[model samples]
Target: MIIQRLDELAEVIEVPLATLNQHYLDTNFKLKVPVHFARQIEKGNLNDPLLRQILPSIDEAKSVKGFSQDPVGDLNANPIDSLLHKYQGRALLITSPQCDIHCRYCFRRHFPYEQAKKRHWQTALEHLASDNSIHEIILSGGDPLTLSETGLLELLRQLEQIPHIETLRIHSRTPVVAPERALKLDWLAALKASRFNVVLVVHCNHPNELSDETKTLFEQYRRADVTLLNQSVLLKGINDSAPILKALSKKLFSQGILPYYCHLLDRVEGASHFEVDDTPAWQIFETLRKELPGYLVPKLVREIAGEPYKTPIIKTL
Candidate 1:
């Protein structure tokens, strides 16, 4: 279902109120956890200091400026329900407007999910089906995996019915935030069973997010013949350092996940604090090039509105 409030999600996931309370107290109640991860809550307390470092506080959300509700020009697009066709050939379907964790650097934190749902989604699908140029469909949003197994399966079935669509890509952070959710073998099997070539693009910012459990899930995806790619956002105090980036890239490769795109922060209203200027970002890319092989290095890029492709961050100096 649609989870709007944190409490509603906690109850559905069967997470104990005390456990959530402890996490809140650890993060000083300012840090908000995403609904998907909150659903799989078990036991134990997170290291308060470490939790504070990753989780964003409600107060800190107020401090940052320029992070708008509609970052990446999503609102300007002629959205048909959850589908956004800002770029040609690929359609971004906001299958689920929920995420497993409320990342401090999320550009869509203030997005109007309600408006997204009100638009006629089926019209967008029909548009994709009729277009000969549109070959790929990108499942995005808070996170596509937040949608239930049945929901995702139904969506996939419908997508596969279209004649022009050949590639189905899913961009999600759920596998990192809630590893257990990714362990759903039945869902993996169903995804593999689809007619389209399935690709899973995951977002993993820090090496710490890649745990053994995540590794096992990757192995499952591999066995299901799903091509796995990773994209990370450069965040200050999170993963902007060269060493951290290298380690994260190396770890992802070891798990058969390719290093895809390292995106510059989308200058949303609340995320200015995480934005690393182009100068330093290019330097980090240079450092990575020196340390890692060509294939291992993720392309440093920025998403410009109306552009057909991501703009590569080039060093002119």
Candidate 2:
């Protein structure tokens, strides 16, 4: 079940109706919390890390400098309505226009889903086939896993015909936020038999997001030879602390996932409230490096418009 109303969420988490109403903001990017995720929040605790990431607040209405609707230049990189080829050798397809949850800090919260054209399916496929330089195709969106079994399998079938494509990468939060819906036997079976190397990069912020269901799902994917990895955003008052991030990494590894990228929050207009400043962001990463093995440390990076790759935040003297 999905919770889209403040009153419904308040009832589940035991937060007072009056108190919840004070901070809630009914914006275009409205509330969309999966029941599986919502149950993990600490009842009556408004400051829960998981809750903070999803709950819309009045703070989103603030106008902050250096923030815009298209923070990562997604629109500029979009050659076609359905495809985005930002980084070389890889292309991202908006496989689905919706997600199970609406994270407050999502950089794509303001994305123009209405603009996604049905005709672009063939256009995207033709473009990918013609570009021998592009070896990997990334399935992203709201969440590609949200697509129906038949729809997803059919899309995969088409991509398999592209002789040059060697890898299939899917970036989705579903495996973490809504494991029940994401774990499909048919999809797993298809991925196992696919010629391309399959990597499923799941989005997870806090350690609390990792649960028994996620563990079971990750194991299933692993058995299918799917490389399981996680990426997190460094958000203010969320998973910004060294201790919290450290815990997250340890927990992820325990469940057969690797820490991939710990991104500095994109300066999307409404998500400015979640941004952690450069000084503290670097400091947190430096501390994290000291506490964990090198491989366990996620690369601290930021996405800059027009940059060839994600720029790493190198600590300075």
Candidate 3:
């Protein structure tokens, strides 16, 4: 079940209306939270890290400089109706425009997703076939796994026909936030048998997001020869410190997922409040380096609008 109202959300967690109403922001983005994910929250605690990421905030009304609707230039890079050709050798397919939950800090929160339809996939796939340089296709969205089993399989079949595409990378938050929606058996079978190297990158922010269900689902993916990786946005107060990040990395590793990237919050309008300054961000990274082995340390990076690749934020302030 999805919760779209503050009252419904409050009822799920058993929080009083007065306390919940204080921080709620009724905006066009809307409140969208899955019941399973909502159950993870600590009831009555409005500051819960998971809750902070989704609950529409009054802070979003502030107009901050350097933050924009097209923060990473997604509109500028979009070459076709459903395709975003950003990094070389890899292109992103906007497989679906709907997500199970609406993260307030999402860089694509304001994206014009009306064109992300199955009808547009043919055009995007043709572009992929025409360019041999594009060897990998990242299935991203609001969340690609939101596609039905049939929809996903058919898309995979079409992608398999492209000889030059050697890798099928799926970047989704569904596996972490809504495991039931992502763990389709037919989808897993097709992925295991596919010719392309399959990599599933899940967006998981806090260690609290990991659970037995996620662990079991991840193991299933591992059994299917799918590489499991995770990427997190370094949100201020949510997970800016070394201890929290370290615990997150260890928990991810325990569930067969590697820490791929700890991204600096994209400078998207309304999300500026989540951004951690470079000096403090670098300091946290340095501390993480001391606390964990090299492999466990996620690369701290930021996606600049026109850059060829995600820029590593390694320089000390």
Give candidate 1 misplaced runs (Cα > 4 Å): 1-31, 34-54, 58-67
TM-score of 3: 0.98
Q: How many collisions between residues are there in candidate 3? A: 0
lDDT-best of 1 and 2: 2
Off by over 4 Å in 2: none
Worst window of 10 by summed lDDT in candidate 2 = 113-122
What lDDT does model 3 reach?
Answer: 0.92
Q: Encode model 1's per-residue lDDT on 34-114: one tens digit a residue.
A: 444443333233323223334443434465555565677877775576778877788888877667666766777677776
Question: Candidates 1 and 2: which is better by TM-score?
Answer: 2
The runs of at least 3 residues in candidate 3 whose Cα sits more than 4 Å from the true structure, single-residue gaps closed, are none
Ten residues in sequence with the least summed lDDT for candidate 1: 43-52
**Number of the top candidate by lDDT?**
2
Candidate 2 structure quality by residue, lDDT tens digits, 183-245 = 899999999999989999999999999899999999999999999889999999998899999
Clashes of 2: 0
Task: Give all candidates' CA lDDT scores.
Answer: 0.74, 0.93, 0.92
Question: Residue 53 of model 3: what lDDT?
Answer: 88
